[model samples]
Target: MGEFAQILRAWRDRVRPEDVGLAPGLNRRAPGLRREELALITGVSVDYIVRLEQGRAVNPSPQLLTSLTRALRLNDAERDHLFRVAGAAAPSSGLVPRQVTPSAQRMVDRFRNAPVAVAVHTAIYELVLWNPLWAVLFGDPSSQSRLERNVAWQHFAGSLPVTHTPEDDEAYSRDLVGHIRAASGRYPADPDIPRLIDRLVEASPDFARRWKAGTVGELRTSRKTLHTEQVGDVVVDCDTFSGGPGDQTIVVMTAAPGSEDEQKLDLLRVVGLQRLGS
Candidate 1:
């Protein structure tokens, strides 16, 4: 095998199934993540993964590289190496970093059974990583494409089940646009940033107007009501914290202590993903 394929298989063999949320079932043939499991997590076909590992697939796109980087939990250096081997340029310091450190992944894993829902977003608002509670709270984001995973895109152009008052809607829109604008300035080298802006400008008149007005604001703690089929309507306090490189934002959703919303969240946690799927 070529150097790229050899290292890819080595990395795949080193990562345990449980590390990526898969159950460590009894009597497995391979020691680490199987080809199918990697395909499932990275949203690439199993055939493609096999081809990649065999050095048959060449010139993987940057998006595919990003997916694999996240799926294999590659650190910054490893991520850059993956890019170099794949004949792609690694994101520079000026670009938004999408690499999720092992520590951050552990942090998210810690909240797997917690009542609080957590999700990690890139500088440009792309939803990169999230916990099971996050999936239970806000439908599973794994099925969404890279562009569809963006928070700003969902609010402006996609049908996200968020209910807000007129005032709250106005403020939230401004905050999202402001953050996107700031990210654009910070990560000008990231092509996705400008493409996202252009798509939003074309698809969302509200976003276009705000962008034209140059409304720059900070993300603030806000209350939002989410309508879920299992839990009905639940209100949550949405809080964001700066995390890792690339201006990644760690968002936590919690309900007021002892409130009905809290009770609902607890119920959702107990119900879990299997029940939600059923």
Candidate 2:
């Protein structure tokens, strides 16, 4: 294998399955994530991963490199090395910082077994890291496409699983647009931000109107009723914190203590990622 392939494999072998919200099942041979698991997280095909690891795929795209770096939980230096080895320029400092720092990752890891749902998002709302309980509560984000992984795009162009009052919905729409606007200002050198805005403006007239209206606000604490087939409706208190490196935000969702919602959340933790058969 080439140096790039060897290094990639070694890094992949270092990341445990549990660290990325996968169940560390008993009877496992290797402790690290499987190639298939990495493929799933990076939104790439298993065959592609195989080709890359076999040295058949040379000079992988920066997008793929970034995804791999995140999936393998590479540190900043490792990320730069991955880029350089792959014949791609390292991500510029001016770009919106997407790498979830080790400290931020540890913060997410600490809540792996907690009943509260937690997730980390980039400045532009790209879903980065999340816990198993978050998967149980909000569905598996890894299953979504890159664009689909974006919270802003999902909120404006697509439907959220959560139900909101009309007033709350309006306020939330404005708030989301405001956050996007703020992100655009903060990461002016980022190409993704402009592309995202253009897509949103084209796809949703509401977003276009909001963008034209110049909504500019950050995400704040809010309440929403999340509906899932497994748990029905769960009223969760959503709060965003500046936890990760750069403009990343850690989102935490919790139910009222001693309430039925809280009990349901606990039940979700027990249920885990097991899908019930019809």
Candidate 3:
């Protein structure tokens, strides 16, 4: 089978069998849920999912595709890809997996000051664009691996250096990782996703632990504490937006209680000017 078809089959085949509360019977041979059980969760016949993986059926109805996504516990990126294949389009051939639309890129550029990042709808938030504001907030040096750039990896590893206060850092980290984890359930199969996944699972014990939980979440606004080294501890209101197509997202961050971070942001223009002068 081609890489695309193989990736789909492998995604369907692996599941946190325990995550679904299935028995870990001695007879079980695989690491994930059984195909029949998946049918039960998604409310589709297991045989049908089998057909899609086997390349026996193309152009599955949208409704049926949706049902399979629910059943397979697919994430946003995976769901969009499933829709494409089901709709009879060939999978994209980029060496790295991305589905960013021009509209989404424009949105990222528009938020020049806001730390904006657009990701695919799947568990692995595929990266398309990240602005200077994001680089500043995350302490992201110029070099980051294609996989490390994904939000999911950053959230779990806490490897990205964002200037948050001590009191707020843990809470902020937890919510970010949890939300990304929840988002993954929307798409299960997009080629180019699993490579980084395998690498991450091997490199980080924390990520490997959480990944198996199969938690699902929708992007929503909420209050959280963030600690900026320059501003001390402050509350921030975070809002997330769903994309028009391809399940992209826009996240905007603002300082709450009019924190000092706001002052720093207001002064950013001067910094830009001084750098230009020098």
Candidate 4:
């Protein structure tokens, strides 16, 4: 096997199933995660994982490597090593990194039992980290394609089924466009930002119009309503905390204490987990 394949196999064997919120299933031959499990957590296809482990897939993108690093719970040194072995450069300091930092991952884990739904998104609003509650409130982001995962893209492309008044919707659209414009300025060298802008401009007339308008803004605390399959209209307060290399925003959604919305949120947790498990 090549260096990339060998290292991947070693790391996969080192990681335990329970370490990444997975159960140790019956009649297992190995103690660590299965290739399928790794593929699932890393958001890649099983065939792709097989090809990667067999050294057929060479030079995986930084984004794909970052996902694998997080899924395997690799430390900083290991992550860099994996990049090197895969014939890719390690993400440099001061540039916008697609990978969520260990500290940020820990923070996300800490809110596991909290009622709030928390998620981290890139400056361009691409989701990178999310809690179970976030999945419960807003469908699982894993189901979305890489391009469809961005908030701005979904909003302009009309993929997200958010329920809001016309005024609120208009304001939200403006905010999304402004945020992307700000991200483009902050990370001028990021190729993904420019590519995303070009694609949106080509595919979405509304997005093209907004881009030309050039109104830069930050996504801040606001109140909005969401329409879910299991639950009806649920109004909640949304807040954004910015950090990380790419100015990633940690979005937290919460309802007022002792309100009806909180009750619905509680029910959503149970129903959502059940749906996910199935």
Candidate 5:
């Protein structure tokens, strides 16, 4: 089994939906941390978190681990335990699987106006089925191996290809990464993310300095300034929805009304479609 898988199992078994303050429900199949619930608490997407727990991803970063830890509400003792589970030296890059259940997939489809995505508590955000605009806005980037299309990586790495000042770039990166940080308690042992941490520390002084200061906790809503080539700058409100197979979250983001987000969405969608076209 992958390192994160064991840790994921531990996280799942140790948590009850309501223990983390989620309402109790009767439809859960995975027992704990439905990928969507985990994503909501951890501020990751259900799809991404699912892969981390299932061993689909091989590496995750320490910062992301911290986020998952925070989201899961694990104390320092439990946090350390997760690190041990992931094997101090494994990569932290993992992807949540994309098999949305029939009902869940229908729910995603119904979220037509929302730019929604799902991730696991482990910080794996998968584009289960996004709206048409979202498909374009968060288009597949060449910068990623099929694996790196995870939204968090795109926004943080500043590789989403939106044209904006460096100022916007930094803010986008922070929120993207911060959301992951917020969910640290659940997915402490992702595979490739640890290596990404090493790279970020080596590459960006800003992230290097703030990496240690990451705020960990159950994710709540936050604002992000985005730079879309089409929409100059837009502030988006990210809302999280939890409950699913277990402990996962589906995060739906919408630009505040009157924002250029719609235009930006159109642009991203256009460009993304072009890329997908080629």
Candidate 6:
């Protein structure tokens, strides 16, 4: 095997199945991730993984490499090493990073059973790393495309079926655009932000209008109404906590304790798990 292939094999061997949210089955000989498991988590085909590991696929794109880095749970130094071995450029500093830090991952894991929905989002508002309650409250964000996973894209693109007052909806739309503007300003050279902004401008007239308005705002705690198919309208408080150089935000959704909304949320949790299992 070539140097790149060798390095890839070593990294794959270092990642435990449980580390990436998989159960280690009985009769398994490998200590780390199987190639199939790695491919599943990375959103690539098993055949592609095999070709890459055999040195037949030498030039993986930066995006593919980034996804592999996350699936393998590589640290900064290791991620850079992966890039170097792949003959690709290491991700530049100050880019809108999608990789959730180990600390941030642990933070979300701690809230596994909390009676609230929690998720981590990139500065560009890409949804990454969400708890099960978040799936219950917001539907399955995992099914969304990379751009569709973005909150701004969801609102402006009219993909998410959210219910709000006309005035509040307009305000929320403006706030989302403004937040994206702020993120763009903070990370001017991030390649993905420009493409996303350009696409949003082309796809939605509302987004085009708001982008020209140039409003700026930070995401703060607020109460919003969510409409679900299983339940009717659920009102919850939305809170955002920011971390990392990329300005990733941890979003938490909660209803008042002992309130009817909280009861509905509890029911939703059970329903969500059932849907996942089925």
Count clashes in each candidate, considering only residues at least 3 apart in sequence or on different chains. 0, 0, 20, 0, 71, 0
TM-score, candidate 5, is 0.44
- List residue ranges in candidate 5 displaced over 4 A: 1-104, 112-129, 141-143, 161-185, 223-236, 242-247, 255-278
Number of the predicted model whose TM-score against the real structure is largest: 1
Q: Please provide, for model 1 over 122-156, each residue's C-alpha lDDT reduced to its tens digit, 9 standing for 90 to 100.
A: 88888988988788766778787988999999999
Taking the tens digit of each residue's C-alpha lDDT, what string does model 4 give over 52-104? 98989988998888888987777778888999988889987545567776656
Error of 5 at 260 (Å): 7.3
**lDDT score for residue 39 of model 4:** 91
Q: Candidates 1 and 4: which is better by TM-score?
A: 1
Order the candidates by lDDT, highest first.
1, 2, 6, 4, 5, 3
| lDDT for each residue of candidate 6 in 228-276, tens digit (9 for 90 to 100) | 7777888888888865634688888889999988888888877777777
TM-score to true structure, per model: 0.81, 0.78, 0.49, 0.76, 0.44, 0.79
**Candidate 3 residues 1-278, lDDT tens each?**
44335556777676655444345567777777777777665566888757766777666675565555544556657767766756544334332224444455445555654423222333345454554555445544236665666766665554543445565554454454455554443444544455655766777776676557654455566555554454455455667775445556666666634556566644442443344346
Query: What C-alpha lDDT, on a 0 to 100 scale, does residue 211 get in candidate 1?
Result: 98
| Candidate 4 weakest lDDT stretch, 10 residues | 93-102
Off by more than 4 A, model 2: 1-57, 60-64, 276-278
Tell me how far the alpha carbon of residue 214 in candidate 1 is from the true structure, in angstroms, after superposition: 2.6
Worst 10 residues of 5 by lDDT: 89-98
Per-model C-alpha RMSD: 3.2, 3.7, 18.4, 4.1, 12.4, 3.4
